[model samples]
Target chain A: MLLALATASFRIESSFRAQFWFKLLSGVLNVIARVSIWQSVFLHGAGSTDISLPQMITYAILGATTFSTWDATQILREIGADIRSGNVVSHLMRPYSYPVSLYARQLGARAHEMLMIGLPVLVVMGSVYGFQLPASPGHAALFILSLLLSIFLLFTVSIAASMIGFWVMDMLALEWSLRGTLALFSGGLVPLWFYPDAVANTVLYLPFAWISFYPLAIYLGELDLLSSLLHLLYGLSWAVVSAVLVALMWRAACRRMIVQGG
Target chain B: MRQSLSLYLYLIRLQLRTRLQYRASLIIGWVAQAFGYASVYGAIWIVASRFEKLGGWVWPEIALMLGFHVLGYALGALFTLVQLRRMEELVRLGTYDTLLVRPVSPWAYLVFSGFNIEYGGHIALGIGMMVWALPQLGMDWSLLTVLQLVASLISAALLTGSILTMIAAMALVLTRSRYLFGIYFDFWELSRYPITIFAMPLQFVLLSVVPLGYMAYVPIAALLGKPVPVIGEAAPFTAILAGPFMVGVAILVWQSCQRRYQGAGG
Candidate 1:
């Protein structure tokens, strides 16, 4: 699933004009980071006394990626819109699985974003801030693996949210509210570590932390392999539970479709 | 001017009527916006609680600044929602030509044509915050202070509206630009806090290039009896200047865009 998503994301960068703006924004971010005090403050606080280029790049990637997950629900809404418009029937008739197809498209979109927007921004920000690279190859590998897992967990959460549209008409408000909550709580706008300890402790139990904080923590060296593995275990558990709920919802939704001829 | 006032009232009434049709949705949107903004402010408050002051400004002063900023943003967004959202559509479809044909000034029509009455809720929220924060900040009430606050708000509205108009003008040139407006909005979002939080160069950029500093900073500074840093140094004079500058810039941009417009469905 992760491989498919990564492939799709890459495909988008190759095909779309979105790369121009992505590059422009990334360049602007790089310039801003180089000149802006906010960048210095963030770097000073996040890294050890001395920040390196790689560490800064890693932080930039982690920040952008974490924030990007907020868009997952929007992808779900697009899927729901397809279903409402009878487009889903065509996909259902195809040999390929419906969920997998949607997932592929989403993965493509994210891959495109990661390459065009995320990578350049990270590189620029890293160079400007002089961020340190990971101390060892093993840590880098661990970070990459945890990041992949985080993407999967985020995808699952989005699927779950999108499934709610099948039961409710006009999921716009609900989707927005959910996205806003996720952005606020999932360490997107502000890192979870910055929150009061009591709040952070409570949020750790929620699924949102797995979507952003855990993966970011792994990259920041805040979490070692053992701890990352434990976090992944929690994420996989949530994914299974969410997948089951989605299956149940899909079955019920199918029944509704037949009865209502929708 | 009398005709413009009447037209503004008529447009506002029409918007109010349209918004009343979706009472629930309007209320929900308002609540959601208030909650979202409040959460960010809450975060700021939490951070400030750890420190006695930020950039030489204490909590109440910060609250006042936020109050003005929120009020200005809400007013700008509500009044200019259609222009902000549809600048690209107008440019692409050449619908802006219709405004040119109307007897009213194209700039006036463009800025005031589409209103979101729902944003009235935001104004209420801003006022509530200002009132709430006033006592917390240990402010003494006076007639002059009240007048200054009202004047500052009016100036803020003008400054914000004009800046949006300037961005919209860019749309006329960059038709089909996906995130032109989004970029503008992101800039606006960046302005929510005091410009002091940013470094000196950024502070200059915000003041001169974007003029966001003129929005709430100037007015709030004057109201708080602080030395005005930029245009706010003139206080009421600069406050009055905002509207004319907006009208002038809007007219200039519209005139230039008119030459580029080729007409719709050609």
Candidate 2:
């Protein structure tokens, strides 16, 4: 999944700049290195006995992917504008699904962001800060899987938010507020661990937690294989539930569609 | 200048009346915003209770910083809402022509147009926090201290207004560069802590390059009787003076950018 996302991002970025793809690749690597280095310094100061290096890297990558999803609302806003301007009907008449096409485009864009922004930050962090590597190959593989799950969870939430535009004329305010809420709740800015225990306990049950922190925790080996599997199951459940909700909303919106009298 | 000042006051009044219409939403938004910040600060307070201080700032000192931070934020929120939103709309529709056609200076019209009075709630809440925290800090009731606080707040307001205006001017030149403003907010977050906590290089960057220090740090330092080399002993005066200087620079930049405006749409 990461490879696919990285490739798509590289392709989109390349369209914008000849050297962008290479630069993005190198940048991501640099971020990882830098983050790893920073963690080493932190570990040295705090002592390495308690925290896992590989887990921190995994968590950081999860954060980067979640942050990259911010563009989803911008894409939705563009679509909403097209609808308001009477351009959407023509696109709807085409053989392709409008929302699906948007998802594809967004996926492409997100891939690019993950590569250009996420990867570089990760590499820079690793090299500059020095994080602890995973204890074993199995742990590294588990971390990778957890990250994949995190991406899927984030996509589901973004798509659900964007789907609100099917009925609402302008979802900009809603989109912005939802994005801010998600960023705060999903541990995108600060880790959920930093949150007050009372609030953290309440937020942990929400779907937003699955978008970033759960997968991150899993990768960090904070959770065992069974716990990681449970997290993935919860994430998949939310994805399915959100998809169904979006489908219902889209169907109702189509029925209520009153194209303004031209 | 008298006529323009009158016009600006009228414009501000108009904005306030418009905002008054949405009393319910305004109240709700105010509560939501306050709760949001309260939760974050609550977390900080909880963590601080575990340790005496983090990075040399005690709870009371940190609370003061928080007060100033929220005050600057509220002041920015109250003034910049219209300018910030219109920035995108102006770029997309090229409707800045409307402002330019006005009798008053386009800069004043643009800057003062959209006042979100809802932010007054946040400012009020900040003042409440300041009042509550002051007694805990063992502050004596003195005329000099009161004067210093008022002066510092005015200076902080100027510093924030100037920074925002500068960013808005930059938006006029590079319409899509608003994300840079988000990066700027990250710097604002750093200012929630004492300047002395950071390494010398970062301290220099925040103090000199961004001048975020002028917004809260220098004034607070002055209040605490700490030495601030940039503003010196008369930090309140220096800080207040900094606002007009920065705003002057911002206006000059805006004028230059206006000359270069190709207009977004035909």
Candidate 3:
């Protein structure tokens, strides 16, 4: 049954060709847009960017594909809305933890997205601009670990962001702000290596980097094995810290919900 | 026509007042929005300023491009983006049925009713950026150039509004299309940079089919006397004409879609 829930997203994708088109077109636009920005820099402003033009294209395509999976912002917005309207009570009374169940549901949904959207977009994009595979099997294994780690970190952030429903009347403002912060810090738009020295260094250490950037960087062989392993540990540490925060927030949210009982 | 205009204004004013009632949400939403935009342009600035110029555009010029992008979307947000965004919600709540029974055109009413005044702040912000960037870019703005700039902006907003209306109209019939509409912003993200950077095929699509040039690049190109590759400077003139033309087509489409409306709440 849980497996069916995971594959449910694929059902939606299969029902309508429109969703597939939308995701594909959007992903293509993302790559084109990123390439355009970088092409300008590398073609005319090459004196500045450390990453080669080809590398930037690879990064953009990979970065956009991250959304082919269940995005944190969507999960955060849905959960926030559920909590706000006390729909969370339905889940709260269940045998399992609400967040845990959410994790289960979303993980399944993401699996569907991976097959229907993520892989197909990569194949299309890879054919167009070409994709860079891992340099070695070792790097390939490391990339997978980093990618999974990123998903874990993303969930932590999503949970923390969703907790704002305890206080805020609307989730749009909170979601918008969190997305902005995430896009910048997570290297969703531009890789951190291109940011100014202070920003690059600071953002690199933040949990956000693990969400998309570091994993893609690893796949590109941009990080050495030792550095990749070290960063993976660092990412795990951030996840642990974030999970603690999520627990505290969940407790507070429960208290708030009880006080504002519907 | 006058009656319709007044009714539209009245409806917009009503929305404005409603939005204002939720003052705290409005203020916080705008700040988040501003920060969202700031980070995008901030990163662009940091990277673009690293060199003398990018694809023949200086850092200050990039600022102006960013201004056009924000200002254009800000206009859309004020007039119809938020309303269009909520069209799907209306379907679920059966509120869309209320619009159908209204005396005015439901298409116009649905498009104009939700006036997000917060976008006004963003427009004002864009203007501030333009003021700061214009002087440094050292462009000698002639009267013709200024006229072209205004016309270009109108073209952009009209073009975008029309495209959105068409999408919304289709979504009204095919409810799933609404989710497709949500992803439409990614298309606009294409306009943040000059069109010259894209390959020939993409340049054709942006110029002819979708016409993103009118949104960001064509106006700047016309102002700076730079030629828009493939289509030339006259590409914006196409946008100017297409804008109102598309609106008419969208209305025609919306009317047909309404004929096919299943009256939500399955």
Candidate 4:
């Protein structure tokens, strides 16, 4: 099953408006952090940090862009609200699959947002800090593949989390808990490598790692080519399992909703 | 004054009863919030493990900052944001009209009716974190120090409430152009870290532009008996005056905004 445990991780959160604010403000903080980091470098004037000042700025900027995931739970919340408001009937009447339609719409919005907002932020950052391209053709291709899987994985997680709303009638708590868990595991703010080994191991292997860490790791050439390929395969299996689970969940949810007329 | 206090308590009681009706769901929300907060708390642990210290503040010290930050925000969020969440819409939806006709203050009516228990959990969490961190600092107990911390914590809450009040008032005036104003809230995330780590000019901005430095950093420094760079030793004592001044400003802004408001489409 694609959705397992009704507790998948790595789906995206936050709104485009929120990101617009977050990234734009981060641009201001990015410069300040750069100065302090460089001062630290000059202070000892030796013993290099794993990530440099320029690279850290890139990470900070990219961190904002990447943190906005394929937010399936948001769509699930939308559908759940429809059910509550007695508007879900229209969606049920439509010829196409409601869940698929939700995914497609989000895909389009994410693409549009990435291009219109995310890319321009990167371009501005690039002008100042000097952007680095992904390591090689093979690695870049694998990174793209991993990114797509991560989005799918996240979407499934959101689906699982939102399905609880069918029973609870309020998805806020579930969503909050899911978001917290995802943020801790996803390494959206910091690289997993920075974490202690015991904590890092458990966090790294989790599905949330694919969300922000893995794809970005490949872009930075932090992962080796072979390991990248291996991770891509592993992530694909997780996505496949989650999808199967989600299909079963959708069936059960619809059956219950159909009975309840909600 | 007693009449108003009774009104406020009665309203809060009504909300609490309504929430308690959904007993299972309400408790679950607190659990969820705890986990959500726990995740951010975990990040601090990870960062501390990797680095010896941040801005000369250890994890215990940082916890004091973070704890007070949560305390201030929890208190402020308890009252103001319920309206600000839909301030522009409240006017458009004519919800404001209902409140305007009320004998009690519109601000009180707006927030009290939408009172949330989500903040109660945050207060507990904030205080729990502070208590947890305090013993680790190994400081001698002093009646004056205890008083200063309590005063600073309350001041921080007032500062937060004032900021949100200003935003709520602004939301009423600038509906279509409210996007930029809403974004200001996001900047408060920066204050979660050690403000001392930030450079001089940015530090100034945090204090003036956001006033978050007062929320955690300034008060926190006072408790630690550490003087803020350049601002000197007097900053801690100044926090007491700043809190009331900020709240007064919030009331003044909220009042002016209410006066300028001529109802929806008027």
Per-model RMSD to reference: 4.4, 5.3, 2.7, 4.9
CAPRI-style class, candidate 2: incorrect
User: How far out, in Å, is residue A119 in model 1?
Assistant: 1.6
Off by over 4 Å in 2: A1-99, A162-173, A194-196, B19-52, B84-94, B118-121, B128-132, B171-179, B224-241, B255-266
lDDT of 2 by residue, B1-266 (tens): 99899889998889889979877656665665665566556645643443446445567777777887788667765777447655756777767767778898776786676766767556866887787777787766689878877766776676677677666666567765454455556577667666665556767777777877777777766666667654467666665566666667767876887788776776
Residue-wise C-alpha lDDT for candidate 3, range A1-262, written one tens digit per residue: 5555555744654676767677667766776777677776777674654566678777877777763222557876788778767788787777776666666667766666666676787788878887777767888899999988888888778778877767775677777777778877888777788777877888898888899889988888899988988988999999899988988988877777763444
Candidate 4 lDDT tens digits, B1-266: 89988998899899889988987778787777767776877776556545656666677888878888888888878776665667888877777888888899888877787777776667877888899999999987889888888888789778877887787787567553345444555556667766767768778887776677787888888778776864667778766666788989988988888878776665
What's the residue-level lDDT of B131 in candidate 2? Answer: 76
* Fnat of model 2, as a fraction: 0.01
lDDT (C-alpha) at residue B221 in model 3: 74
Ranking 1 against 4 by TM-score, winner? 4
* TM score of chain A per candidate: 0.79, 0.76, 0.90, 0.78
Q: What is the lDDT, from 0 to 100, of the residue A191 in candidate 2? A: 58
Query: Can you list the residue pairs that collide in candidate 3?
Result: A6-A108
Q: Give the per-residue lDDT digits (tens) of candidate 4, residues A145-260.
A: 87787777777777767766777777768777777877788876666877778888898788888877888787777789999889888877777787787777777778886534
Tens-digit per-residue lDDT, A1-262, candidate 2: 4445445755866575524543444345333332333343343333223444555554555455334344455765676677677787676567765555655666677676666666666666556445556545666777677666666666666666666666655454445556666656776544576566788898887888876677566656677877777777777788778767767766676677667666
The C-alpha stretches of model 4 lying farther than 4 A from their native spots are A1-23, A26-54, A69-77, A259-262, B176-182
TM-score of chain A taken by itself, candidate 2: 0.76
i-RMS for every candidate: 5.3, 7.4, 2.0, 4.4
Worst 10 residues of 3 chain A by lDDT: A64-73
For model 3, the superposed segments whose C-alpha errors exceed 4 Å read A1-17, A48-50, A67-70, A259-262, B88-97, B239-242, B259-266
TM-score of candidate 1 on Cα atoms, chains taken together:
0.82
